[model samples]
Every structure is written in structure tokens, then in C-alpha cells.
Target: MTPPLEITPLPYHEDPLGYFAVLRDRPGAVLLDSGRPTAPGGRYDILSCDPLALLEVDGAGRVHGDPALAGLSPFAAQQALLDRLSREVPESDLPFLGGLIGYWSYDLGQRLEPVAGQARPAVTLPASRVGLYDWALIQDHDRRESWLVGSAARRDEVLAWLSAAARPAEAFRLTAPFAAELSREEYLARFHAVQAYIRAGDCYQINLAQRFSAPYAGDLWAAYRRLRKATPTPYAGYQAWTGPEGERAILSLSPERFLECRDGRVETRPIKGTRPRGATPTEDRRLAAELEASLKDRAENVMITDLLRNDLGRVCRPGSVRVPTLCGLESYANVHHLVSVITGELAADKRPMDLLAAAFPGGSITGAPKVRAMQIIDELEPSRRSAYCGSLGYVDVRGRMDTSIAIRSVVAEAGRLHLWGGGGLVADSKGDEEYAETLDKIRHLMNALATPTNDDKWNKKDLHLVDRDIDIQ
Candidate 1:
């Protein structure tokens, strides 16, 4: 029977990107955005579009679209094609009425562990790319309301394609200017080889990154609406598929919440300390009170919140995880973090792809013993992190889920675009302040896409935007 889904009630645009700019050229479009038009963060804004299957996985883990998941694996072929799809629970609490939304590639955790051929695969795309969506459109923006769940003939065929009209794309420029594929003595010889593996103890925390590409053409949805108006986050996303290197796009503007779950309760927040907002407001409250009184950023946010409370105690339940917020702080739009939170419960014989295969690519960006800090970030990052720090949101078939640690992301394929920044490096980390804190976490997203060259000395200073106060707790 699979019918049930009809929720209805429309009109709410508090900026759900104008109903995903009319199903963004259909075929598996996604949105998941929550920057509520430019801050105050997420309440719900999940869009969708034609997707009755489109799985993709490669990078040797194989599995590409059905064939009954050609021998599983890519989180068991997304838990066996979302358990053979066709669930119908819509009384509405809205959190993805649809099922699998996309992205997972932080090189899809090298097909779960053993770090495979450690690094430099330089984006061929697809380590994960989902999309099952039976239909969705949920926009709440804290009760300004909007629904449109499904059948009623797919809600009058997505409300006559969201009442047509809206179309303006084409302005996204930047045909070159980003640069930096490590060189400042190759990122200080990979930050002293991660401070010589944290002085031989081998790993205490190791995120470290840097990569900034460029060479774009037009409309990656107008550069994700100019990076969601400069940096409004709350686990932002914007997927777009068709890979094998052509027309790919990810765009995420994440603010770090890597897992949520809901109902069976599960949470995670991580974000291990940073600081680059300060351009006054009394130096942004002295850089959010010096990242809430840094004891080395509260020991790198308590060693990645005790390594995500031991990866959510493996599948949660017994003593059900914990950590309720450590190293708090938040504040975004060009930096100031330290977040933490943890929580758990799931286990009654687990699922949510067993907590996404026991927490995929996150421990605040793979540090503190996450498969040996992802094999020292694939032996010191220099390409390959296809969807930077991976995991974009959605899992719902009423089991609910949420994601986003694709850190201030941006991918866009073939015509180039890339972008990544990074952190977490203990052992008194300071190789010129962790290489100017990885160019101060993406230097205002490379100063919003362009400007710099003339031997671009990392845009010779000048990047500001911080009216602060977005706690994202």
C-alpha cells in the first residue's frame, strides 16, 4: 500500500530558495538547506525532485544504482536500498518524508577503514551519491509553515512545478583566482608531518587541510546563492548529480552537526575550536572570548568530544553514550567555533545504517583516533576529499536523520571549483599558527569566490563579516 504521504498546505518561502528554484532542472535535485535565508539557522527546509533511485558509490567500493545493489557495501547499499523503499508515514513532523538524500564522500571513508591507497586521487567523483526521495518539500522556518509531502498525484505534480515562474541563474563567475594547492614549503612540510605524528604518540588529533582551486563558469545555482549569502549555515546543502565527471555539484555551507537521528534519539555536534571573526565589536568579543577561554581550544574540544563519545559507543544503548556539550561557543559567518554536544540511545538492534556504519568520516573531521585520524588524513592531504570532510544530510523514511560536517563545503566538478579549509592538530600545534589556521578557515570563502592574483599572497588581508550571535546549540 505505500500511499499515505499527503500533507499539503503551501506558500512559505522564508527562502527555501524559492522552492528550490523550481525543482532545479529535475532528475534528483535536492536542497536540505536551513540557512533560513541568511542565518538564525535551521528549523526545516528539505526540498526534493525526481528521484526514484540513483545510488552511485565507486572508488572501488563499487555499487552503482541497483541491480539489487550489486553485492552490497556502501553502507550495505544504503541499508539495502533503504529497505526496499515504500514506507508511508506522513502525519507530519517533517524531517525528510522522503528517504535518502545525497553525498558521503570524504572518500567514502576509504570504503570503511584501511585508508585505501592513501590519498591524491584528485576527484573523479562518486564515493557516495544518494537520492531515493518519494517526495518532499517541507519548509517550516519556525512555523511560517509550508508542507507538500506526496501523493495526491505527487501533490498535483509538485504543485504544477511550484507554480512555474522563478528563473534567474547565470551570474556565478570566478573563472580563476583561488590557487593554493599547498606551498608555503608545502604547508610547512605537512605541518611538520602533523607535528611528527604528535611526537610519536602517533595521533592525538590530526585534521589539517588546505586546497582552494578555481576556474568556474556559471550557476552552481548561482554559486549556491553566493554562498548562502556569504555564510549562513545550520548544516546547509545543495546537491545536483550526474557524475563520471560532468555536471557535479555539492555546494554545502555546513556549520557542523554531523549526525542527528531523532525519535530513537541520537545527536552529535563536534566542531573543534577555531576563531576568525573579529574585525571589531570589540574585536568580536575578543574572538568569542578567546574561543571561550582556550586551554588549547579546550584540548581541541575535548579531543573531539571524547572521539564522539567513542563513536557513539559503537551502536549506542548500553550506558547510551553522553557528553552533553563540552567546549561550547558557536558563532559563525567567518569563524568562531568550539561546539560539542553528544547524546545517544539508538540500539534496539541498531540501524540508521547502524549509525551510518558507526559514524562515517566525522570525529570533527577525522581527528583523535578515527581510524588513525583517517590514516593521518590520507598521509597529509593534497587532493582527494572529494566532498570535503563528507556527510551531507537526510535519511528519513520516518526513522529520521540529519547530517553536515562537509565543512563550509563546495565541490562543483569538471569545470573546477573545489575549496576546503581545516583544523585540529594538537601537540601545541603552531606552524605559523597552524598555517594561519588553514587560511583562516577558507578566508571568507576565498573572499567570496574571486579577487586575488598578482601573485595572490592569500589575498593580502581584507575579509570581514561578523555580527555574531548564532549559537546553533
Candidate 2:
């Protein structure tokens, strides 16, 4: 039998990030921040620690590393985790009394390859992972309310810890400078190669990427704080955990939602088109309009949308999948995007893991004809996309789930900080313009990682730069 969970309200009203700063130093801590405050009535920010169990699946079926994740493929591992959660948590109660939280790396898709001849880089991360939390903090910003959630057995201990953690603490900080893996000339040459594949009918589109890395000498929480402030988005999140190698942290400020399942309905918001925000209102509006009207961008978006529809159809009921919205313009802190919403009714027997297995990596980031595009990506991009292009979020006890595309994210490991930036490539895509677009996407992230002055305090004001919106059409 499972124990009943308890939710005790806390009176602390300070910013959740501050509390998160204190928690990040702890083992198995996970924080999911929507970044900016939500509307009058919105979901609370989540903080959790002390997972009851940790589940990981290696998509490549490699047993040489990480003995725990021995023989399972990505999909098989996801299903196993879901089954374990069901057995541990009663079916009548909420499934998320504390559920799994982690990421699904892009390489996890290797297991789904339909063809055998395609070459791919060696797998770096497990196919899927979820940490089952026994303790959590939910902060409701609109109401200025917070709650401490945990199993009944740990109530008193959790309360005492929360009380002590509520006290004031110094802000976190990181001092690291980043260097790109690709030179401008090298990136342009690769971009042209992707274009050549597109022209050859090998693939209609492919997402090309470049990685940037820097040495770090400070708290990761402070770095995440700067990232949130610089590029606030609806799907920002922070996760810290110990692994076979050691401690690992992921800071994601993604603006895209990969998959969300609630009440038996599943939906995905794929972002395909991007235009940098303009300096003035008039210029911003013009850029938005141009993005909507761009033939190439729209075609690229539709291709991915079609791919997603097919992916969803595999697990969804027959004729239940539909596109509710198509190519709507959405503006964020640094850029404007063309987003499309696709929804479907899950099959009666399908679980969240089933949905993920069918669509582990979102179509928007991978490009059209996902598997083929991924093979081409491996051939062109120099390094593996460890956490970038992955999915991060939670799966609740009720079976409700929400995950981000893991773009605009940073990974801290081995005393170094890593970030990636890229965009979709089509036959008409220009190498130079595509290269410039990657720069636009990463400008704010680069600024956030710039060296701080003598006081070790970041000058948030100076980080905001004038928008130099470009036309990629």
C-alpha cells in the first residue's frame, strides 16, 4: 500500500529563485521555473529533492557504461519507468504525489531508426530518465502562496528544513567565458552542405547546430539566474542530480513546448520560424508580419507540422489528431517565432511513455522526415547534442505531463558550461543568413555568460542590446 502525501502551506513570499539557490547545492534537487510570473491564476513553480528512485534508459542499448541502464532501449526504458510509478503510487491517488523529472536526450531517437545503413555519432546520454521525488515545493506566484509537499512520513523533517532555508542568503554567481566549437567560415561551409542534401531530395529540411563551451568557477544557480533574466520564457527549468560520472546540472530557458498531456489529450507546440525582435515597435511589427508571410518559413513550418501529425497518429486514436492552430506569431524577450499547435486524443490504452516513444524528439528541432534528417545531422554537426534538443519536464501521478524542447539551454559539467544554437535549413536557405540567425538566437545567452566586473555582480541593465532584426526569407 502507498502512503498518503501531505501538502503544507508556507508563508515565504520571496522570489522562488532565491529559495532555489539554497536547494541547488543539495543532492537530487530539481527546479522547474516558468521564468516570468504567470497570470492571475497559474500553475506554481516546482522545487523537489530526495527522489525515492531514479530511472534511466539508454536508447543505444549500450551496457559498457552505466551498468544500471543495461539492456533497455529508449522506449522500453520509458515504459518500464511508467510501470514502476504505477505500482508505487496507487491508481486512485494523484500520480504526481511526486513523479519523475529529467530529460530525454536527442540521441534517444537512434533506437527508432527504420533503416540500418545510416551512420550516427556514438550515444552520450541515456535515452530517457525520470527522478521520483519524495519532497517538493510549489510556489503560486499570482497568490503569493507556497506549499511544502511530501509523503506523510517526512512531514516534520521537511517542515523544519524549509523553515531554516527561508532565511536570507547571498545570491549565486558564475564567472565563465564561452568559446564556440565552430568558426564562422566552418559553420557556413557546413550550412551549405545541409543545403546540398536538401537540393538532392535527401531531406526537405535539417536543423544545423554549433556548440559553445567555457570553463566555470562559481555557483551554477547564479548562472541560471542570469540566463532567466536575459531570456525569460514560459518553459524555463533547472535540474541538478548526481550521476555515474558525478554531479550534473541543466539550465533551460526554452521558449518552445515539446509535448503536454492532460486529461487524456496530448498536444505539442512546434516553433519553426524565427525573426529577431526589432528595435522599435514599428520595426517589430514589420518583422512579425514578414515572418508570417515568408513562403520559405511557412513551408518549413508545414513540413514539420505534417511530420508531428504523423508521429502523434501512431499513438493517438484514429482520426483523433488535429492541428488547432497553424503558424501563429509569438514574441519573446529576444525574438519572434512562428508557432503551430497540434493536438490529439490518446488511445484508450496508451500511456504518457507511449506518447513520448512515438515523439521523443520534437519535429521542429529535428526537421522534416525526422529519422532521415537526424542521420544527415550526424553527418554534418561535429559534436553530439547531449542536452540540447532534448525534452525536460515532469509526469504527474495523474498522468498529466509537460515538457520543453530544451533549446536555449546550458549544461554545467566537468567544471565547464556548454550551450548550443542553431536553426532549420531548407533548400532555399542561405549559408550566411543561417549562420547569422544562429548568432541572433544565442546573443542573449552569450551576454549572460560574459565576465562580471570587480564586485562579482552582473550588470543586468547593460546586457540588453538593441534588436538588429534580419530578413531570412
lDDT, residue 18, candidate 2: 69
User: Which 10 consecutive residues of model 1 have the lowest summed lDDT?
Assistant: 464-473
lDDT per residue as tens, model 1, 1-473? 55667788988888788788878888888888889756755788888889788888888988877887878888878877776667667466777777888888888787788875567667677888887878888888888888888878889988988889877787666654666677667777888888888899889888888776766676789778877888888778898766445788888888888889988899988888888888878999998998899899899889888888888888989897888778888788788888879998998888777897788888888788888878877878856778888888888776778888888788877788777777888898788888788778877776776544454333344322121221110
TM-score, every prediction? 0.36, 0.87
Q: Quantify all predictions' global Cα lDDT against the true fold.
A: 0.79, 0.73
* Best by the lDDT measure: 1
Q: Looking at candidate 1, what is the lDDT of residue 161?
A: 88
Each model's Cα RMSD: 19.5, 5.2
lDDT assessment of candidate 1: 0.79
